[model samples]
Target: MVQKRISEAKEGKAEEPNLLQKILSMTVQERKDFWDKQFMKCIKCYGCIDVCPVKREEPEELSLSKWIEKAKVPPPYPAFHLLRAYQVWDTCILCGECEETCPAGIPLKTLQDITQFFSPEDVFELVPGLDKEIKDVILRFVDSKRTQFRRVTYGL
Candidate 1:
């Protein structure tokens, strides 16, 4: 099935739009509505959280997980989702396991892809002096101009 679609796309015979193009075409309000609907459907199963490999873990002094707050279902708008998104921004491998494990069918992969598309150089940029070593590495990367910014940092 997938090979046929790829062949048709190569031959310019595929009629359906790609997911990224479809997402990019949506108006801000439409995108918000779409995400809101999906988020509202979440049952707070924590499956995505469990499957995510990038979730931040504080040092031994602090709690095991400090990034994701323990909130109620429907998670007070985008807080839960955004926290998870940002926590995984730098390290997400796009493994699709989160989506696969989600019982609510929240389309975690699609949401994560959109987040990744917009992710900045450092996910903790706003937090001052968090990881100086990594920051120095990134600065070197940027100054060297060895590759495009996204390619160097994100492997895009």
Candidate 2:
């Protein structure tokens, strides 16, 4: 499989990598720097969450604010955007609203894509009943932040 992919890349038949693949392929420091640059541009408007269809109130037992308090614009390492993505990891609908609503142009939807869409199969091994394929859809991410995804074969 590895050799096939290498040969295909050399032959120009390899599929173009998506945002999730491209971002995940980055080195640790590169990923951190990418996120830092993206988050640093945030004005802390919370517009991403405001426009999210999956936005839900944080549960007390699983609260995240204690560990990551609200701060000024260009907030700390784990900004609200990151925390919000963590909170919705299991329930994200991937409608692409958050990315569209972000004023700073952060690619927040890619986080959702990376976590649930293209993630490794064992990621949900501990959750006996969780079927990751059930979340898969005909979604694609372009170079721009206009990636749109709708649940293709399931009723919401």
Candidate 3:
């Protein structure tokens, strides 16, 4: 199943890379080691965050990985980094500015692309479950911020 999906993606038949193949291509240990090395090179310069279009709109109070770490333990429902990662699917222009600006040379563009493949639903599915409370909370937050923005402005 995974191999077929990867082949399909490579052939452009699939919209994105197979999530399972992306995960299986690297072992858990490999991922840990890769991230460990990348994290070591991070200077916390916020360049990546600044370049991230999603972060521009959302403006995370913390760095990307820090947000992920925090979301993993307590909240678990609305993982900001996970949402940001998937947002790359539509928002990423592939201009590669984030990768170029990274002091760590962590291949931010590739990572974002692959992660987006795995979780495209996160972009459209603001509320994964039918939990009305969670849905209402997200709707209120998003609508409040977006409702005032002009659909057309400055004759773009």
| By lDDT: ranked, best first | 1, 2, 3
Report model 3's TM-score to 2 decimal places. Answer: 0.45
Clash pairs for candidate 1: none
- Better model by TM-score, 1 or 3? 1
- Give the root-mean-square deviation of each candidate in angstroms: 9.0, 10.6, 9.3
**TM-score, every prediction:** 0.59, 0.62, 0.45
Single out the weakest 10-residue window by summed lDDT for candidate 3.
Answer: 121-130
Candidate 2 residue spans exceeding 4 A from truth: 1-12, 61-65, 117-156
Off by over 4 Å in 3: 1-24, 52-55, 59-90, 120-156
lDDT of the candidates, in the order given: 0.56, 0.54, 0.47
Off by over 4 Å in 1: 1-15, 58-71, 119-156
- Which one wins on lDDT? 1
In angstroms, give how far residue 71 of model 3 lies from its true place: 19
- Cα lDDT tens digits, model 1, 10-112, are 5678877565444555556666676678788887777897877766662222221443346667664354555555445546789988889988887778766
Q: Which candidate gets the maximum TM-score versus the true structure?
A: 2
